[model samples]
Target chain A: MKLGPSRFLGRRRPREYAGGGRKAAVQLYHVSKSYTAGHYALRDVSLEFGRGEFVFLTGPSGAGKTSLLKLIFAAERPSEGQIVVLGRNAPRLGPAATPPLRRRIGVVFQDFKLLPRRTVEENVALALEVVGAPRRDNRAKVFAILKQLGLQHRRFHHPLSLSGGEQQRVAIARALVNEPEILLADEPTGNLDPELTVEIMDLIAQTSTRGTTVIVATHDYGIVNRYAKRCVRLEGGRVVEDAPAHGATP
Target chain B: MSRAAAQLASFLRAALRGITASPLTSGIAIATIGVTLVLLGAFALLVANMERMLDDVGDALHVTAFLEEGLAPEAQRELASKAATVEGVASVRIVSKDEALARFRGGVGRGAALLEGLSENPLPASLEIGLADGYRSASGLARVSGSLDGLPGISDLTSGQDWVEGYLRAIALVRGIGWGLAVILALATLLIVANTIRLAVLSRRDELEILALVGASRAYVGTPFLLEGLIQGAAGGVLALLLLYAVFRLVLPGFEFGLELVLGGVAPRFFTASEAALLLAAGSGLGLFGAAAALASESRP
Candidate 1:
């Protein structure tokens, strides 16, 4: 049956599944990433994340949480694994293939990696611009996203002029501007107050309601306890637990 | 908009943004290029004028052969005829000794009475022979002298060999100096262009890196800088042309009368349209290559 324009068109496609129901958004089978011969960031890790899943990656500073996020974003390749992101094998795809994959995934770095010279509006507009959106549409979409993030008033101000919380909001606005199907945040609230931390986590949880899968990597246990979503706990490069926060133990 | 037009617009906007970000540095670069181009233009004019002057001097000279004192008019005529038949000789004119004395008296009219004490005309009849352009060299004149030395009535075969050799050597030296100056100045021009481009690129490195991160092709990042280089070069070339014109105009009037007496007209020291066009093309090419080299060298992983 012809069902209008495919929802997956220009959106993230589902990852391939052996038994398909709601196919996994991200699937890593026996994945291992090693920078050098004796050092492996992730070792034989097998995991699957279904569509619209909200998961927390908790681990100590050097426990491979960041590495796992990097792999998902196609920033780094696995030495031995099948990393399928939105149905495309990460290792098989070359440099040219990464941009399109990246366009569908939103990334909020821990350092709020915003261009200091650009205004808040411009920072958010970059995401839309990268995806080849029309100029007029990009302007309107960026403004709307900024207004939603409570940063419309500071649109003309550069990131350096903004407070930490405001800068974090701008970063979030930039990541979510393109309405990416997958949102990846690394230490999104590591520098925020308890109230601000809950607010950021609530915003992430709300985004998953709109069918956007959110994966946040952090060392903050307080946030994971409060949000109480599916937690993928890692210790020393191995997944110690992959289960729902308040569900039956597995 | 068409695809190329859209791309061009994007590049233009980006270049404009870059220039706005650092106007002082760009201005300095443009001025440096202008000065270099002006020097090169002046050198070109000097070479052109020197070549023209040499050509004029070579064309005006000839060989003059004096006849023996006891030679008859018939013998002188036969000798003139034989000299004209020489392979390198273009034309021969025979002047009798009496005619020579009369010409000398006319030249020094007030001193004519001083010459009356002479028993006879001291001047000897001479045959002046014009040499072809290819035979105007010292070696060629030597061949002509060998052919005419044994002819009847010909006592002395004197050509302007010394003067010709001196002029040839002077021209060769000047040409060598001009070439050396051109080479040194061209290298200076290249260095100036390269440094200017490097500064411009350094100022825009952040923008370039951002473009790369966004998946903009390398060509997209590089085309505007190349265009900027071409614009600077063309502007510099025109500035050089104007500066040369001004200098020539200031100096030309003072030399007009003296030059007219020497060359029969005022000599111009400016490039013709075709030559100016060549200078402009060369300047633009140099600028483009300099920018390309800077880009290639600075683009690292």
Candidate 2:
């Protein structure tokens, strides 16, 4: 399948590279993962995501979309392949190297996984606290991001008290608080209503404009179709189609 | 605040938050630790004072010569007078059976009532002799005992030197047992705290994974639990010290006169500054150790 830039829909076009020149933000070569004998979750899958690109990974249940994203996030090691994330060799990075690498990357899971006992702002500020950022700086960044997400009023509320959509936004806010170079979101809108879905997707799509590489794994075709970005469809542990943005010349 | 100071404050806050979050579990853990520390403190106090008592008894060497039952009063007096002139003997006095019985009743204290039912005094009259200063050394004492052996009309001799040696042996045995008990209790503390921390870790497993995902270091993820354990242990130590002080200053004093009748009234001493500090330090150190053990065994994805 041909892959190229798509229409920006009146937004600033996120820069796209013509071919491999600068190192990819994420690259997987011949990657494979297995839980037991003869049941591979991923197999010989090779893909590259450039900096400042927004891509969608689409598949039905058991289609390896989550596995592929997890591999890139360094949450799981490949059985027999080389995976490089933002320049460091993933498998060789060891335990000591994961935190720094993970700091440069942000990941959002479907469950939100917000600390229930922490307040909304405290939950978001956790991203800054771990890095030993100054309290004033952490507070400023947390509040600014919360305000941008329309969550300033709920900053002091506990996560459990927030609705599903609000919690997801807080999760996203936490992911983007540090201005990470890469963001991996898995089914971020799976539990949201239609209107909230669009709001969350738009919020996520807006991050690409600021030079953050975003990869969203989802089964929602309508959402994917509307956004009209590069889409990689996975089936049975392999990439079946790599389609570029709609209305772009191949 | 400085960066390190800020981090410590954050860690402490997290620990306090955790403690307050599950008061039941934390309370149970803290109570278990406090009781353990009190037991350790009480044992230490007992052993320290017992050793002091042994030292005092060791320094005052004396010999007792028992006469056969129903010995003539003149013969007892003659024997005591002769013993007083023996070389290395400082002084000698004869004690009647009545005096012996009175001393026995006094030593037994509350148990003195048991003797009231006795048909007659079973005690034997004897000569109580003190050793001169030169004969108080171990060798000198042994030599005096040898001289006293097989004296005329003397049935059996009890030497303060022998009792002192026996007391030392008993003290050593007791200390060995105390150390063993301390070791066992320490191991129990570690296991209990480790299990408690492990449960705490499990309850917050999602948060820990999130922290790890957000680029928090293992040390960062584990520090708060370490602090939790340290606080629990140190708090338990403080509680134990309070318990010990209450026992020493309030409870044990009421029994002082009775105890003096038997063990000579050497009151149990409270732990010194260094000893109390050690307990606190040990409590915190064990807390850290327990958390470390739990972290080591944690199964990370």
Candidate 3:
């Protein structure tokens, strides 16, 4: 049922997502984002996440983790540097080009970002609707994704009716439903208990296993240690450490 | 289907949802549009009817040259024939004193009893001359009247040109005021629509930002608001048309009759199809512009 990439139809396959093509999933070069004069949220940060890699961006609050993720999603542009996502210069993408770029990258926020007024199925279908995916295919994909996330029973319920874990899963379903080339999660497990935290972490790990380059940002070193992925640490808007997780092979 | 067609359908659905979500704002906007359009339509109808009345008077183009009180029948006939031969003159008919008296009685109707005290006919014999088509203008009528005034056995000349000039001035004033009001009302409608749509945009900024973030283009996000504006504008126009029809059918006839009492035989006029269609188009234009204004202001970083 899948037609080939038609850019005008918003169905173009980005380089990283196209059948295991090898490319930098994300690259930042001397990137800086400042909200106020002389107050940098991220300053001269250069980083890279390889195709099919799982990485964690670990930082305390206000350590520019969110700002860097936003740059990857093209939500915020670098003040004085370049950001390349899925092999496209993210900061240079024109307004018309940005949405298609965003479609190839999935993002989950700390607050879940699920629409409270929409049912779980509707929330997940939003990604498809915006791109004009066929209605029948959208319903099938939404149901399949919801089932994969173990939220199939709650598909008809509003986000407000779900627990924190279920809602976060729905948010993840929305993010991953389009099979994006890259997944950026900013503290997805921030509000969950330890049991739910491990489940969400494992779910994200599974996507990385499917060759979707996944970057999860958090201040929680416990999950980072348990999952044992490569870790990049940030402090005061700069990367302080970059290494494999404690139990992971180099 | 094409991506744009799909997008349009989605936007329309969203726009309908938006309207249903906020009843008060949408109602206020639609009501404001209706009121503004009604005022404009009424003025247009008034102007149309007044122009019709003026044309009815102008088409006759009659000027009466009164013969001297003691002029002989032969002399009066000669005066009438001479008036007919003037360059702009179409035809001339002589009215004797008896005919003048009979016309006056017919005009006064029941009030003709008041003229019974006069022993002899006090009205003068006159020659009523009709000007040709091109001579009905102010300058044309003036030239013909001037020539008739110099004719033999003529004492005075009178024409409806003065009345036409007065009516023309009234029409000019009405038109000026109508246009002035139209501009003011149009601006008011624009501002009202813009403000209302702006409020809707502000209320939904978070939703819009999310749409923007989730692979929705500017058109995808903004088209629904544009549709909202268009629907609101069209609804207002339809309401105004309905109200105008009600007024024209139920309330205007009595007023028209009273006007006829003062200025006889003038009939009321309503909006023609073309005029109504223009009003609808204008209303939709207002809606589109208002939505555009809202979208532009919100697009700022």
Candidate 4:
């Protein structure tokens, strides 16, 4: 009630989270979210995304892929159950407390969500700026991240001037600039061509290799088939398939 | 640079961008604040000068105890000594009938022949009383005058207390009206400025959503708006000061006769350095508060 630091008393790690003796990065216990009465975006669903895991949330429009991602990021509270992310209860955090938690979890979107007026470097530096990173170091870190994404030359260009693939890279650069522990992308390549789709997904997949838990909510099965990764398929607000990936690549 | 300085730079950049993004709205807010402060500052100056004039008048406290006509010189002298001992009376000097007549002739320089026709001296011998510092106000004047009223040798007592009281009342009335005007205008200015900033904030709803998506806190998000308001307000204050100074210098001297009648030999003046700084600070305060109000209102629901 005080909106202070939370002491979650009942966080005894469940059996589902204890995979290979490591706790999950994200866990939901029958979480349900409803925007209105008798209607739900996500209902009676439970899932776990482990540290350094790459998971794809595949479902049709309104199948709650976005809702599940929203719940994990604390964008909206679960109506029925608890969600634990980065050892903190997502539902218990207040408006003031949410930012610190969000700082550690990077998010990307289909629309890129970049401030159009700002250049690529400025947009990417937003993550560091929020944490009060010094300007010299902020520039250095932004440069390093943009370079990693191969968009360093375009850092000074505005997002509006960038191609769809390039804008998504800017978004990914911002998401990875902080080296967040958890990366959630809501349809990161939804607007790109088949060729650019592979390019963007490769960057996001690379984040998981660096021990960042990456969740990409997408409806594209072609990209999912290309990579052998754990895939959670949702239908009518319920998870009908939770298939763990067989290998890193097929 | 330090982390704080980096954050400060970020906030200032955003604030400047916000102001530049909507120059017309920002300019309107600044102008309204300037106009409001100008009116308020003028009233404050008037009240300050009036109070100073009253202070000067109070320092020259003088009371006259007009003695009964044909009183003996020895009796008048005795009465003067007794009056000096009265509470609140600092000193007394006896003005004989002949001296009073001579002073009257000097006062009416061109009309001395009007008094030359008089058979006997019409002026009475009196005691000129100087009041103590504590007895310089209206209440003190009344207390001292009452004590001398029924004295055997004195026919009447008169002092400047009555006229001072009337003038003080007039000053109070003007001050009251000034404050009333200030309150109404301040409220109007605050509302307009608040709405202007609110509209500005609302226009950037998309940017805010993105900031939120990137995990920016409420303070982190709202600080730019606050700074924008503060800059606008301070600019407004500077504007008001310049306008007031211009009016005081270029326009005030044109009404020299009116100023002389009201202020006497006292120079009509402009705001001192500290007073001008205070006006600027007030404008900044209005702008800062207006932005805060806008942020608070927008946050609700």
Q: What lDDT would each prediction earn against the true structure?
A: 0.75, 0.83, 0.84, 0.87
- Write one digit per residue (lDDT tens) for candidate 4, span B59-165: 88789999998888888888988898889999899988899999999999989999878999989888999989889888889999988888898998889988889
Q: What stretches of model 4 exceed 4 Å from their correct place?
A: A1-21, A245-250
Best by DockQ: 4
Considering chain A alone, report the TM-score of candidate 4 relative to the true chain A: 0.91
lDDT of 4: 0.87
Name the 10 consecutive residues with the lowest summed lDDT in model 4 chain A: A1-10
DockQ for all models, in order? Answer: 0.19, 0.62, 0.49, 0.66
True-structure RMSD for candidate 1:
6.9
**Model 2's TM-score against the true structure:** 0.78
Candidate number that wins on TM-score, 2 or 4? 4
Give the better candidate number (1 or 4) by TM-score: 4
Question: Under the 3 Å rule for N, CA and C atoms, how many clashes does model 3 have?
Answer: 0
Model 3, A137-212: lDDT tens per residue?
Answer: 8999999999999999999999998999999999899999999999999999999999999999999999999989
Give residue B105's error in model 1 in angstroms: 5.9
Per-residue alpha-carbon lDDT of model 3 for B121-163, expressed as tens digits?
Answer: 9999988899898888667788899888777798999997787
**Ranking by DockQ, best first?**
4, 2, 3, 1
| Best by the TM-score measure | 4
- Give per-residue lDDT, candidate 3, residue A51: 80
